[model samples]
Structures are given as structure tokens and as C-alpha cells.
Target chain A: MYEGVVQDLIDELGRLPGIGPKSAQRIAFHLLAADSTDVRRLAAVLVEVKDKVRFCRTCGNVAEGEQCRICSDTRRDLSKICVVEEPKDVVAIEKTREFRGRYHVLGGAISPIEGIGPDDLRVRELMTRLADGEVTELILATDPNLEGEATATYLARLVKPMGLRVTRLASGLPVGGDLEYADEVTLGRAFEGRRLLDV
Target chain B: MSLYRDEGVVLRTQKLGEADRIITLLTRANGRVRAVAKGVRRTKSKFGARLEPFTHADLQIYAGRSLDVVQQVETIASHGDAIAGDYGRYTAGTAMLETAERLTAEEKEPAVQQFLLLVGGLRTLAEGSHPPGLVLDSFLLRSLAVGGYAASFDDCARCGRVGPHPFFSVPAGGVVCASCRSAGAVTPAPETLGLLAALLTGDWAVADASDARHRREASGLTSAYLQWHLERGLRSLRLVERT
Candidate 1:
């Protein structure tokens, strides 16, 4: 271990989600050697973010006010809602520039191993939003992972009686991927979900 | 700087830094090993997608002082997408992976039986042949057996009694005679006991044909038995939507 303050800094950095011990140590040292003004700016930003950012009351996406920019936008389509697991996923979908509908951030997927279930997410809020019957199409854009799938399935069953058109994102081979390297399950899905040419 | 190659299943993964991950793998030869996959979080990384959980991969690892480093990885079977697409199967598969990690409980020790069982369990789960719950129970029972905690269902676990015992006790190993039954022993239905036995012995026909009540009872007993042996409940098991 290093001296008192250095060790403390390293430990704190290590506690972050993706920062391990070695990386923590490297970052701590980099900070110590960095200009004081830069470190101060980073510290200020961290505190500022914590003080300002909050979840949108309507959709659970990160926000500075009661609602996120997407929820407040008048131009976006309110008839369709794209549900995702996290705010980062909203950014990812936004990068595509293809979706013009509103978004509902679930905050996280249903992961029993982590003691996270539908109750722990923003499902109730989503149900509240759907109660109005304004949304005609509900697209489940949760990650194509086990937890995400579980969450999607649970939501699908819960909302089945509501008469909304519920759908999940189609998953298959990634672009530029080799067919020979594709797993049997994914390859099979691609074949089963094959679509006809529109030309 | 010794380098070696082995086929392994990605049991779990945790982010390490800006663009790296710490992967826990259960390998055919090296048992359960923790290794650092540098820059695996980067979009341009060659083997990033191949090292996800539930994936069976061929890996070349360079042994490091604190942790081994994964140098190269090639996908053998990517079960992640398949397992993730279904809820029941996903939860079952997660429990299986957690069980494998818990059973091995050591690094670099050869556990060929555990490895094979995990591979088989995942393959069966992905195939969606039988109920995911039944498959999970079977995998858990077999894994416990491989870990030297095999529960006795046909005969008494404590005393050497012959015929099928009526009492099932987690603390006493498995089925127990009336005289050898523990304080908290439960008298499950005869069918439930039969279902448990079928699961432990890979009798899928008997297991598949069993009624829902018996299956639920068997599942409860199997989970209790597993927790008793592991000294803790598996987190993934609680989330499984039993069919």
C-alpha cells in the first residue's frame, strides 16, 4: 500500500464500477501529478453533476428538471414509446437518428442475481404512462441480454391485456460479421426472421 | 512468462477500467480462473464480443503475477444471445453459471466433471428441449454430486435403509428413514421424491412426465438441498420463473 492519502484516493477510485486496483492506483497517481486546476475542475464537475442531475419523473431518464428533453419535446411522436434499460441506451438509439418517438428508460433490467426485479425498475411509472391509452406501439429496446430479456418478457405479459402493440427489437447477426463464426442460435434466428425484399 | 491454451466457459465478467474487463472462466483444464481481458470494452476490440457470459471460447492466456491475462480468444459457442432471448432459460442458465463458479471455489485446479456438466447444461438450456426449471434442477443436482455433496434419494442418507424413504431432509443429505429423519425433515409426496431421484440420475423421461405439483415440490427440495450444501442461496435461482 502507498502512504495514507494516496492509499485513500486509490481505494476511492477502485470503488468506482469499472476501476480496479491497478487502474485505481494509476489514476490516483495521475491525479496527484496533474495540475491542481485540472483536478479541481474534475472535482467540481463531479459534485455539480450529483447536485443537478435527476431522473425524469415521466420516463426515468437522466434529467436536470422534472422531465427529460425527450419527454418535453413537442415534436417527438407520443403515439409510440421506445423502452430501454438505461439512459446510455437512449444515447445509443439517438445516435442512430432513426427513431422519432418518445423514450421510456427503465433504469435497469430485471436481474434476480443482483436482487433487481421489475419492482426495482421504473415499470410502475411506465404502466402509469400507458394507462392513458395514447401510445399505440410499445417497442421493447432493452439490451439483448438475459436480464434485459427477462424484464421485457415480464413487461410484455403485464401489458398484454392493455391492447397495445408490444414488440421486441429483432436480434441477429451483426453487420460485417462472418456467417461461419455466427453461433447456431443466432444463425437460426436470422433464418427464421428472414424478411422479403421490398424492391 | 508461461502461455497456455484452454477451452472455457465465461462464467462472469466485471468491468475493470475505461476499456477492459475482468473475466471469470471455468475451463476444462484450468478449473475456475480469473483473468484480465485488456481493452475488451472497446468497440474495435477483436475478441470483445466473444468473451461475454455464457460463451464457450478457446483462449490463450499469459500467466501474470496477480492475475492471468487473456491474450487471444476465439468463440466456440456463443450461448449469450440464445440464453438472453428467453426469460425462463436465461434465469436457469444464470443459476448454472453461478453454481459452477461456487462449486469450483478455487483457481487453476482441474475440474473436468464440472466443466463438462456446465457445457452440457448450457447446451441443453439453449436447445429448449425440456422445461428450463427441470433442466436447472438437474444441472444443480449433478453439479452438487460432482462437488462430492451428492444427495441420496433412493436409499436413506443417514442409515442404510433399503426401500424409498418418505422423509426428505437437507441437513441429513437426502431422503431419510423415519428413525434417522432430522427435526426439520419434510415428508414430500412419493412422486416428488421420485422426481428428485430422476433429476439426480438424468432420467429425463420420468422428470418430464411428472405432474406440476410434484415438480414444484421437487424444485423446492432441490433448492433447499443446494443451499444447505453451498451454505448460501444462489441469487439467480430466486428470479427463475418456474413453469
Candidate 2:
């Protein structure tokens, strides 16, 4: 371990999700060598973000106040709600510009191995959002992994009685990728979900 | 760096970096192997989907200093989609994968039996021929047997006395004779014990014909036996839909 505060900094950075010990040490040293003004700015922003940001009341997406930008925007279609595993997924879908509807961030998928289930996520909040019967369609854009699929299944079953048109995102070949190179599962899914060409 | 080829089932994966994952597989020849699959999270990755859990694949790996590197992956059977498509199968398959990983324990130590069991279990699960719970119980019991914790259903686990034991004990291994019965031994239905034996011996006709109540009882005993031997219960086991 290094001296007092420097070692503390490294330890704290190492606590982050993806930052390892080596990267933590490297980042700590880089911060020590960096300009004091830059360090202070970063520290201030960190504090400010924690103080200012909160989860949206309706959809559970990260927000500055009561609701996230999407939830608060009246222009977004209220008849549809896209369910995603995380807040970052909201940004990804927003980037696509194809989905004009609102979103419901589930925070995380149902991972039994990780001791996570439907109760651990914002599933209740999503159900409550659909309780008013305004939502005609619910798009499950959860990742195509085991946990994500489980989450989708759980949600679909829960909302089955409500009679909403629940749909899951398609899993298949990536755009601009070769068909032969595609994995059999993906190719099979593509075939299963095949669409006819427009005239 | 030496390159070796092996057929294996992907047991699980963990994120290593920005675009890489550490995949753990039970290979036919090399036992349990953990390898880094770099950039597999990228959209354009050559074989990202091929390395998912429940996929049996032929892999070309480059031995690295710490963890091996996956060079190329060819899909032998993609059971992931089939298993993941249903909730019951997904949870059951997850438990099977976890059990296989736990049984193998040591890396690159040629656990061919466990590997084959996993592949077969996955294939059967994907095909949806048998109930997911039955497949998982069979897989777990067989895996325990391969790991040297084979539970004796017919004879006493301790005294080796023959025929129709009354008490079932997890720590004592399986059904115990009246004289050999210890404290906390459960007296399960005779039918439950029969179902377990059928599951262990690959008597699918009997297993398929077993009653639901007996199946649940047998599953409970199987889980207890597995957990007692494994020391810790599998996380995904509780999530499996028995009904």
C-alpha cells in the first residue's frame, strides 16, 4: 500500500464496478499528477451529480427531478412503454430515434444466480404504470441473455391478465453482418421471425 | 502459445473489460476452462452469440499466461435459444450449468463424464422431450454420482442392506435402513424414492409416467442430497419452476 490519502484514493477507486486494482492505482497516480483545478472540478461534479440526480417517479429512469426527460415530455407517445434493463438502455433507444414512446427502466434483469428476481427490479412500478389501461403496447427491450429473457417472461406472465400487447425485441443477425457467419441460434431466430419483402 | 481444440458447453460468462468476457466452459478433453473472449460484446463480433450459456461449441484456444484466449468458436449445437425461449427451461438449464461448473471444480482436468452429461442434458432440455424439472433432477443426480456422491435409493447408503429402505438421510447419502437411520432423516413416500431411482438410472418411461406429487417430493429429496454434498445450494435451483 502507498502512503495515507493516496492509498485511500486507490482503495476507493478499486471499489468501483469495473475498475481493478491496477487501473485504480494508475488512475490515482494520474489524478495526483493532474492539475488541481481539474481534480477539484471532477470532485465537484461527482458531488453535484449525486445531489441533483434522482430516479424518475413514474418510470424509474435516472432523473434530475420528479420525472426523467422522456417521462416528462408530452410529445412522446403515452400509449406505448418500452421496458429496458437499465437507464443506459434508455439512452441507446433514444439514439435510435425509431421509438417515440416512453420508457420504463427495470434497473436490472432477473438473474437468479445473482439472487435477483422480479421483486428485486422495478416490476411493480411498471405494472402500476399499466394499471390505468392507457398503455396499448408494452415493448420488452431487455437484453437477449438468460436473465433478461427470464425477466421478460416474468413480466409477460404478470401482465397477461391485463391483455396488453406485450412484445419482446427481436434477436437475430446484426445489420451489415454475413448470414453464414451468424450463429445458428441467431440465424434460427431470424428465420422464425422472418418478414415478407414489400412490393 | 500453444493452440488446442476442444468441444465444450458454455457454463457461464463474466464481463472482463469494455468489450471482452471471461467464458467458463466444461470441455470434453480439457475439463473446466476459463478463457477470455475479447471484443465479443461488440455488435460485429464473429462469434458472440455462439459462446452463450447452453451452447455446445468446438473451440480453438490459445493458452495465455493466466487465462486462455478463445481464438475461434464453431457452433456444434446452439441450445441457448431453445433453453432461453422458455422460463422453466432457462432456470433449469441455468442450474444444470451451475452444477456442472461446481462438479468440475478444477480447471483443465479432463472431466469428460461431466462434459458429456452437460451436453446431453442441454440437448434434451432444448428438445423439450421431458419435463424441465425431471431433466434437471436427472442431471443433478448423475453429476453428483460422477463427482463421487452417488445417492443409493434402493439400498441403505450406510449399511448397504438391500430393498425398500424406510428413512432417507442427506448426510448419510440416501435411504437408510431402520437400524442405520440417524436423526433428521426424512421418511419420504415410497414412490418418491422409486422416481429418484428411475431418474438416476435413465428410466425415462417410468420418470415420464411418475405422478406430480411424487415428482415434487423426489425433487425436494434430490435437492437436499445435492445441497448436502455441494455444501452450498445452487442459486438457480430455487428459481426453477417445478410445477
Candidate 3:
């Protein structure tokens, strides 16, 4: 252990997800050698983010006020709602420029190994958004892994009686990839979801 | 670096560093092994989906200081897609994976029986031939037996008495005789015991012909017995759809 406040900093940094003890120690040393002004700016930004950023009321995406930028936008298509697992997912989908609808961040997926279930996510909020009959399509963009698929299945069953067009993102080979390199599961899904050629 | 080859099932994975993942596998020869797969989370990863839960794969691993590094992977059976397509089967498969990891308490220890049981269980689950609940129960019973915590459906678990006993106790190992019956013992139906026996011995005809009520009762007893021996209940077991 290091002396006094330096040790305290390392402990706090170590508590963050994916930041282990070794990385925490390295980051602490790097901060110590940096300029005081840069450190102060980082500290100020951290405090300001905590004070200002809050989850959107409609969706669970991170926001500065009542709603996120996407939720507040008037030009976005109101008939579609794409559900995702995290705020980072919203950024990823946004970069594609293919989807112009709003999003619902579920906060996380249903991972039984981690003791997480549907109740732990923002399912109830998404249902409320759909209750108004504004959304004609509900797109599930959750990850293709086990926990994510379970969450999507749960949501699909829950909303089946509501008469909405529920759809999940297709699983297949990645773009700009060779077919021989794809895994069996991916290859199988690609064949299952194959499209017919239109002359 | 010394390298070795093995065939195994991917039990689970956790993120490491920026793009790598620490994959835990239950192998036919090496038992439970944890290895790092570099850049596996990236989109262009060659075998990312093949390392998912319930997937059977042939792997080449390089021995590391603390954790081994995965060098090559070939899919032997991609049961994940078939199992994950349905909610009931997915939850059952997850519980099986969790139990496999839980039963093998040591790393690098050979557990060939446990590995074979898991592979067969996953295959049965993916095939959707029987109810997922039944498949999970059978897997749990067999896995417990391999782990040296086998439950007795006939004869006395506590005493040397014979004949079918009435009282069943989880802590006492299984069905107890009248002379050995103690507090907290439950008197399950005769059919529940028969169903459990059929499950353990792979008597699929008897198991498939059993009634739904008996299946539910057998599942409760099986999970209780499994948790009792494990000393802690499996978190994923509760999420499995028993019906």
C-alpha cells in the first residue's frame, strides 16, 4: 500500500467496474506525475457530471435534464422504439445513421448468473411508453449473447398481446468479413436469415 | 510457451482489459480451465460466437504464468443458438453451465464424467426432445452423482434397510427408512421417486411418460437435494421454467 491520500485514490479507482488493482495503481501514479491544472479540470468535470447528468424520464439514457437529446428531438420518428442494453449502445446505433427512431436503455440484460432478472431492468418504463399506442414497432437491439437473448425473449412475450410488431436484430456474419472465418452459430444464422434475390 | 489441445464446453466468460475476455471452460481432459481470448469482443473476431455458453469446441491453449491464453478454437457443436432461441431452454442451459462450474471445485483436475454429462445434457437440451425441466433435472442428478453426492431413490439413505421408504430428506442424502426418519423429512409421492430414478438412470421412456404434476414435484426435490449438497442454492436454477 502507498501513503495516505494516494492509497485512498487507488482504492476508489479500484472500485470502478473493469478497473483492477494493477490498473488503479498505474492510473494513480500517472495522475501524480501530471500537471495540477489537468488534474483539477478532471476533478471538476467529474463533480459536474455527477451534479448535472441524470437518466432521461422517457428512456433510461443518460441526460442533463428531463430527457436525453434523442428523446427531446421533434424530428425523430415517433412510431418506432429501439431498445438497447446501455447508454453506450445508443451511441453505437446512432453512429450507424440507419436508425432514426428513439431508444430505451434497459440499463442491463437479464443475467441469472449475476442474479439479474427482468425486474432489475427498465421494462416497466418501456411498457408505459408503448401503452399510449404511439409505437407501431418495437425493435430489440440487445446483444446476441445468452443473457441478452433471454431478455429479448421475455420482452417479446410480454408485449405480444399488445399487437405491436416486435422484431429482433438479425444475427449473421459481420460486415467486411470472410465467410470461412465466421463461427458456426453465425454462419447458421446467416443462412436462416438469408434474403431472396430480386431480379 | 507450452501448448496443449482439448475439447471442452464454454461455461461462461467475463470481459478483460479493453477487448479481451476470460473464458471458463469445462474440458474433457483438463477439467475446468480459465483462459484469455485476446480481442474476442471485437466485431471481426474469428471465433467469438463459438466461445459462448453451451458451445462445445476444440481449443488449443498456451500455458501462461497465472492464466492460459487461447490460441485456436474450432466449433464441435454450436448448441448455444438452438438453446438460446427459446426462453425455457436457455435458462435451463445456463443453470447447467453454472452447476458444472460449481461442481468442479478445483482447476486443472480431470473430470471426464462431469464433462461428458454436460455435453450430453446440452445436446439433449438443444434437440428439444423432452421438456427442458426434465433435461435440467436429469443433468443435475447425474452431475451430483459424479461429484460424489449421489442421492438414493430406493433403499435407505441413512440405514441399511430395504423396500421403498416414505420419508425423503435432502440432508440425510435421499429417501429415509421409517426407523431413520427425522425432523424436516418430506413424504413425497411414490411417483416422484420413480421419476427421479428414471432421470438418474436415463430411463427416458419412463420419464417422458410421467405426468406433469409428478414432474414438477420431482423437480422441486431434485433442486432441493442439489442445493443441500452444494451448501448453497444455484442462482440460475430459480430462473429455470419448471413447467
- Order of candidate numbers by lDDT, starting with the best: 3, 2, 1
Better model by TM-score: candidate 1 vs candidate 2 = 2
- Give per-model TM-scores: 0.87, 0.95, 0.96
Question: What is the C-alpha lDDT profile of model 3 across B217-237, one tens digit per residue?
Answer: 999999999988888889998
Q: How many backbone clashes does candidate 1 have?
A: 0
lDDT agreement of model 3 with the native: 0.92
Candidate 3 C-alpha lDDT tens digits along A34-57: 999999999999999999999999
Worst-scoring 10-residue span by lDDT in model 3 chain B: B78-87
Give the better candidate number (1 or 3) by lDDT. 3
Output the better candidate (1/2) by lDDT: 2
lDDT of 2 by residue, B65-159 (tens): 99999999999998876777788888888899989988888899999889888889999999999999999999999999999999999999998
Model 1 residue runs over 4 Å out of place are: A1-45, A170-199
lDDT of 1 by residue, B1-243 (tens): 489999999998877868888999999999999999998766445677778789999999999999999998878988876777687788888889999999998799999999999999999899888899999999999999999999999889998798588998899899889889889999999999899889999999999999999999999999999999999788888877898
Measured over all alpha carbons after superposition, the RMSD of each candidate to the real structure, in angstroms, is 3.3, 1.7, 1.7
Clashes of 2: 0
Q: TM-score, B chain, candidate 2?
A: 0.98
